[model samples]
Target chain A: MSEHKNHISTYKSQILVLLTLIMLTVLTVVITSVHLGPFNTAAAMLIASVKAAIVLLYFMHLKFDEKIYRFMVTLVLAIYAVVIIITFFDYLYR
Target chain B: MTGNTSTHRLPSYLEYQGKYTGILGWILSTDHKRIALLYLYSQLFFFLAGLVMGIFMKLELIAPGQQIMGPQAYNALFTVHGLTMIFLFIIPGLAASFGNFMIPIMIGAKDVAFPKLNLFSWYLFIAGAVIILIGIFSGDGPPDTGWTFYAPYSLKTNTNVVLSVFGAFVLGFSSILTGLNFIVTIHRMRAPGMGFFRMPLFIWSLYGTAWIQLLATPVVGITFLMVVADRMLDIGFFDPAKGGDPVLYQHLFWIYSHPAVYIMILPAMGAITEIIVTFSRRTVFGYKAIAMSSLAIAFVGYLVWGHHMFTSGMSETARLVFSFLTFLVAIPSAIKVFNWTATMYKGSISLEPPFWWAMAFIFIFMIGGLTGLILGSVSTDVHVHDTVFVVAHFHYIVFGGAGIAFFAALHYWYPKMFGKMYSKKIANWGLIGLFVGFNTTYMPMFFLGFMGMPRRYYDYLPQFADLNLLSTVGSWIMAASLIVVIVNLLRARKGTPEEMDDPWGGRTLEWKIESPPSLENFEEIPVIDSEPYELKSK
Candidate 1:
């Protein structure tokens, strides 16, 4: 177990990430009031995914980690996206 | 003894006393080898229980009317049999038992990245098994939805679906933790000079399996929770009255269950690869291809889950796409089979017990895999969807693939694990009986299924009687053979060890150490210089 220099995030960056998350949450609620039929679920999911990525990158310290960690995150998200799309093949066609 | 400077032989993992003694030394210890034995014992016990349930079910299907059990009893029997075999035995069978024992040593590491977490996973495994058993014996009745736990029926069944689903949820957690432990261990624990490609093929297969365990298991775990929520709170996740789609539930279930099959078989494939290379006295052909193909199988396996849902009312487009993906997976799987075959080409082949078991695995698994393509096709699958053909295909794949490989790995590693050699002549008899009896039991089912016999039924048509009777007789032979195999291994437990350490001239790191390895596997981890399984003559 070798000790290395740690990347400490500035309060400004943390506060900015927090505010963006809050703004996205409000926008999610605001968008639900205006119905876009099928696009409503799509819109909300897109925003939620963005929020998740933000939390993963900043809150989870993945931003300061090795490149392999980021690659793994992308791989997991890719798998999840593929599952949802395959599932929607049934729903969209039906 | 080779790398270590210590003169006197320290205690082998079997006799090493920890914080506590006796059974406590086993159950409470964090050692990976001891934990593997714990899983082996528990798996053996549950496997016997499942085997008994299967025998009773086969007996019920023998003539036409109920032999000794009623319709409802037969339903419960098949349900519990699938549950016990799938969850408690085969799913964790090879990976938990042999993977735990071999992975760290094969990679030249002392222990897994998280030793305590490994022990905790075993405890969770037992807890989950206990909860499932309670759900069986103490409920309103055993779950009759079968192992797939298809929705709508599962939602309304009075037979304790909630408890069983919850128990499965817990078991999924254990799988996830063990998978996590292996991933971290393999990533961080390989000895110096060992690159990713230099590691043994068994480690590669475990790596692929661990990913499936970590990523795919949680999907089913959440799905099981939703089933429980539907029963307890009327949430209607799959309830038709509440506008929840039953097909959605099928989608969710197979999303995990399909990849779960890979979880069962990949480690088995890895074990077979080792046995094939060792007995052939040759280097594995297409080493990089075999390693990459494992990852390919894992990745593609996740996409083809919808093949299980084709007749379950999924859309035509989804079925078509899923069928294509299913065929794609066959490519990588075929790569492995060809590689194993090529490894044995013109080499100094040793007809050992483990090699015979590996041979049986290939032959049986090929039948299973090819029959699987028949089911993977949308048109043919629609015909044999719920028929005995599907059941036969499943048993061939899961039982023949993973089950046979488990025995292969046990025979290959037994001398190292327990420092005792099982009877060669008896082992040969057991394999013949198993192969002959297995084919007799399942081969007729394929014909019976093609002739239109539905599975999970207590009674059948008068015309179906002869084949069903033949299948039942085969089950009796298989059961007797299984007894012979287990008793032979058990008798070896008290026998003397061989003087040599590298009994099979194995090329892996585990073969380089003492038979029945020390407390921490290596005194000082040996540095690697060549590819794993590099034959000296070659």
Candidate 2:
């Protein structure tokens, strides 16, 4: 418990991550405005995923956390990915 | 054990003053235990309300042609029935009441992470409950939009759809906060040496359930908000007029709802795990497997929500994928079922009331899950979709799974909670009546459903009359059985007292304390030096 305090990331890395997230969100909104045909929704979601990664890694502090915490986050994301992919497949095939 | 000194300093609530005795103290007090009692009383009220609605619904179908009520009234009856049972009865009945009382004690903590938030959650639950009841009485009409509150119909309906859906939205917020509190408490507040695996199975199950509640609840929150927006403001998320897809609504609803079933069952499963090992007088066969299966079920449960939409014109490939995933989810459930059964084999088994409920849970849930596989098959589900079969399948799991498990836990923990033992003889009679009445009530519905009796209908074809008559009779019997169980428990509060701690020779830390324990739970936090359910000391 004592070691965890010193191991916490400094202020600079936090600022960098926040900046990156803002840039990604702006890029997503811009992409949505442009008519990319069927690719618009996909492009928006991909950018949103990038933003989510920054939040998970920095704001939630998963980057500097133990391996088990990383495993838990990855496991939940994998399940979500499977459900989304399967539902999309159903939509496409029908 | 110094009896005189102990009685002189009995916990504040237990001091038997004549002024505020019996039910008054239970309903009016701020003690967590008494508040839990309040939740128990209110939940029973709604359970009986739902049960009466169910009886009337079956009665109406006895010979069709609006036998008991008009079509509009019938619609209101079934709509309120589903809403009351799901939101008001089963969801909060087991988890909120029992979880609030036991989680703090189980994990060697004084109270939940946020004690005021705990009380706030209960008040919010009661507020939602009151709104639903007001909808029932106002005669502006109860919500006939079904518990799902599917749109287009929801937007146009003159029923109390807005009030009921708003109630559900409020209930979701309450559930989310409870889950958040449990998550933080479990992670941060375990006693000095109670490691991850060292915690009781009930705690692990609550840990898993809290995650489901946190993750899945937000989706439903967003879905309900969208429904309100569409109905009140004509926002176009689910309106086909605005090019919004209605099927997308089903997707979002089931994504939360399927995991919501796990949310209902997981804590009950945790309760059963504890009951099984304690009564069998043996270690659980696969402790880690049972724990991990809970996590597996929670994870796999989210992916299979699509199976609910199989006949809703989903693509063939999507149907096939959901079908496979649904079967995959059942595997973890099967693993849990087998592990519980194996724990009983070659071990000293006691036929206590809790164990009886546990055994019944296994029997009925197996039937429910197996029939679910049939529904998971794309072709068969198309045949039975929206029929009485679907209703019967769901009731079997919800009633037989969570409902039965609730009874088992109540019986298992009654001594610890009240410091007195119930009459096992009467409880046994209650169990038999419940089993007989339950099967009689639900079994005929499957046949009627296959014969094309649509659910949520006030009137039905004359051909299905006899089965409806049988089901109504069965419901009456079930109601009678429930009354008997409640009376027996109430009577137990005055009977002969038992030895204070570990009445059942239980292994968990909870039984290590005095019955109806001190408010802070343990006088000293216990260090875990061995796995749970290890009967023979090493």
Candidate 3:
């Protein structure tokens, strides 16, 4: 393992990330309030996914982690995506 | 190897102390092993509680006219039976107890990535168990809304649905935390050179199971929260009048609940894979294929939840697509089954108790999975929805598939866990008794269901009396056999000699260590320069 102190992210960057997440959550709530027809739900989820990704990548340290961890995360997300797509298609086409 | 090394000598459970050293040590300890044992003890308690409920259910069905309990009592009995068995017994029985105990050891780690979180999960599990048990005794009665806790009935039921759903919510958190811990442990804590493919199939299955637990569990958490809101706050998520769709409740429920089946069975499949390879003295046929198929099943399992919603007014096209995906999910399951059997094809095979249970799991699960195909078909599912066939199908999968696999794993690893040898003669008899009793109890339900007998009924028509009687009789035999197996294993615990390392000539890393392994598992993690089941070289 490399020197732990050197590898750790700075406090300022952490604070910036936290602020961005807070801003995104606020934006999500505000956007939900605006009537965007069917697009409203989709928009909220999209924004939520982005915020979640940010937390997972930075706060959870997936960005700094090994490639295998990234692979595992990616694989699980890919599978989740497949499930949602297939279920949505079945629901819609039917 | 140092022949005179003190560590070479085996350590008994009493002498084995890594973190906790005494009786109080176990009760309040946070060590993963102690937590696992705590889970084992509590799961046994829940298993027996569910068993008693099952016996009462059978007794009520025996005489046809509510002989043992009232209609309300009967409903509560079956409902608690389902809830306890699913939430308390089946879900945690294999994964939490054995998974917690074995995963770290199997991966050659000192402990789980989150030992404190493991203990916290156990506490949460016990808390949830107590809440559900409180509901059972409250006299207002247990939740009669079924294990699914489906709405309208769940919200409208006079029984303590709030406590039950809340208990389920807490249990879901316990499950989620366990999943999160396992994922991180598997990802980050594997011993120095243990690569993804080098990990045991059990770890692979758990990795898959943890994902299901993380992704799918939250949905059920939200669903149960919605149920609580409906019941307590009257928020009307499932209220047809309040513009909420009851069908939406099911869609949300099975979204987690269906993959929840995979959560229960996938680890059992992993355990069976390990047992089959060990007993047969062969590498698992298509190791990579079996491992990949595990991930495939977990992925596809999520899409097929709609198969459960087919008869609930889902569109026919949706049903058709779901039916196809459900069948596709079976392909990977079939691949696993084929790989296991082919591993056993020409290799040395033992008829040990674990092997017998594995064989039985295969036979029973084959029937269960095939019948599941019949149910997955929308048209046939419509006929059998809520019938005893659905009950029989799932019992075969859950009880036969997961339940028997758990027993098999217990038998296979008992020597390692307790460092003593159970009587194989008794085990053989116990195995036969269980197999016979299991079939006798469940096989008739298929016919009863085919004859249009609906499930969850307190009192059935007289036409169903004879088969019910036979089923009840079989349950008694099963209970006796199960008791005998536990006794036989416990009997070996006092003063018996410690078992040999590689007692079964297994090729896995776990067997490479001493029985009742030391606190740190390995003094030096062995470099994995060979295949997982390379028996010939050994």
Candidate 4:
């Protein structure tokens, strides 16, 4: 448990992560304005995922947590993804 | 152990005066035992409220035409009944009461990882209940939207949907917090050598349920917020005229609502596993299989929510996919049912009230589970979409499965929690009435539904009169038995404190402690050395 404390992010690193997230948000908005057709939604979601990844790693400290937390998150996200795909089955066919 | 011997036996949790005195002590204090009791009292209050509403609804349908109340009154009765039962009573029912009481102790810990958060969730629960009361009473009329609060009508209704939707949102938060607290506590607070597999099956059930609560509750919380916004803020979330897709609301609603069923039943199933293993005086067969199946149900439960929306103009492709997935979730449940039956195959079996309730759970849950398959089939569901059949199926599962298991576990742990033993004879009599009357009240609904009788109608055809009258009589017997059970338990609570630490000869860590355990559960944190349910050798 003491070893986990050593892995904590420094203030400067935390600031850098925050700045990167803000930059990604700006990029997402700018890309949405360009209208990449179907790819616009994909691009926004992709960039949003990157920003969320940064936040989850740095701010939430999942990076410093145990392997079990990572496994649980991945399992949850997988289920959510499957539900979305199944829901889209209706939209696509109808 | 001698180092702390004097402080250990000085006061049980009930007698130990915390920082505050009397009611504030319970309300403000963070003691898990007292908090569990708080939940028990409030849940009982709401359960009776829900039960009375159900009886009224049944009475209205007794003779078929204008019995006691108007159709509008019947609508309010069922709406409040559904809300009170699902949100107020059963959803948080077993988990809030027994889960809080047993989880930390079974894990060999002093309290949950976040004791303050546990107490706070209780407050949130109370706040949610208060908001719901305001929603029903202060409005122009009671929310007639049913507990589902299905859209277009929900938004368009003059009744106070806003307060009720917000109340559900708050209750969802309370549930999420409870789940989050359990997950962290189970991960971080297990005693010295208590491995995950070595922990009791009840904890494993809680682990699975906690995941569902954490992951799935947020969707319904957001969905409720959207409904409130659509009603109040003109956001057009589920309003079809405002370009909002109503089916989307159901998809979002069922996404959480379906797994929420697992959240309700998993702990009950887990409790039945504990009771069966204890009464049979044997090691649990297929421990990993039963534990893993809980996770499987929770996992597959998410995929199967689409079955509920099958007749709502969903695509044939999605409907077929959902039906298949619904059947898939049953495999894991069947695995548990089979495992429990096999555990009692060659063991020494004891006949107690808890054992009887557990057996009833198995029998009725089988009926419930089998009927679920019927509802899951797209073609069959099209025939009986909102009929009394769907109502009967879920009552068997939620009421028979979860509700009866709750009573079984309650009686099994009564001696432990309150340090008194209820009369075996009276309890058995009560069980007889409950079993007989329960079947009588609900079994006819399947036939009525097969006869094409739709549900939620205050006035029914004269053809349905005889069965409806029989159902009302059955409900009276059921209500009387419930009162008998409650009075029997109350009588037991007034007796002397039980001396047997392991009254039932059980092997769980909780059974190793004194009845009505002390404020800090253990004098010394126990070292884990053997299996959770190892029987004592004669």
- The top-ranked prediction according to TM-score is 1
lDDT of 3 at B174: 98
Model 1, range B178-213, lDDT digits (tens) per residue?
Answer: 999999999999998789999999999999999999
* Models, CA RMSD each: 1.5, 3.4, 3.2, 2.4
* Stretches > 4 Å off in candidate 2: A3-26, A33-35, A55-83, B1-32
**Compared with the true structure, what per-residue lDDT tens digits does model 4 show for residues B338-374?**
9998999998999988999899889989999999989
DockQ, model 3, C-alpha based: 0.41
- Docking quality of model 1: it rates as high
DockQ winner: 1
Extract clashing residue pairs from model 3: none
Residue-level lDDT tens digits of model 2 in B1-538: 1011133224623543434667665544545655666677778888888888887777777676867788888877778888998988887756787887788777777777887677777788889888877776775667878888876788789887777877888888888988888888888887766788878888888888988888888888888888888878888898778988788888888989899999989888889989999889988888889999998988888888988998777888888888888899888898888999899899899878888888888898888888898899888999999999999999889998898988899999988887889999999999999999999899999999999888888877879888888888888888889889989998998887776557787887777677877656665565566666667532
Question: TM-score of candidate 1's chain B against its reference?
Answer: 0.98
Report lDDT per candidate.
Answer: 0.92, 0.81, 0.84, 0.88
Better of 2 and 3 by lDDT: 3
Fnat for candidate 1 (0 to 1): 0.70
Interface root-mean-square deviation for each candidate? 0.6, 1.3, 2.2, 0.6
How do the residues B1-538 of candidate 3 rate in per-residue lDDT, one tens digit apiece? Answer: 1111235664533366555457866766666776788888788888888888888888788857768778887788889999999999998868898898889878877789998899899989999988888888885788887898877789898899888888889999999999999989998888766789888999999999999999999889999999989877988989989977787788889989999999999999999999999899878899999999999998889988888888777777878888888989988999999999899999889777788879988999998999998799888998988999999999999998998888888888877776678898998898889888988888889988988999998788889989989998998988889888878877887756655566888777777777776656676765666567777635
Model 2 Cα lDDT, one tens digit per residue, A53-77: 7889888888878887898788778
Tell me how far the alpha carbon of residue B199 in candidate 4 is from the true structure, in angstroms, after superposition: 0.7
TM-score per candidate: 0.98, 0.92, 0.91, 0.95
lDDT of 3 by residue, A1-94 (tens): 4443324879998999999999998999899789987567668877888888898998888888877779878876876667656555544554
Please report the candidate that would top lDDT against the real structure: 1
Q: Which ranges in model 1 have alpha carbons more than 4 Å from their true place?
A: A1-3, B1-8
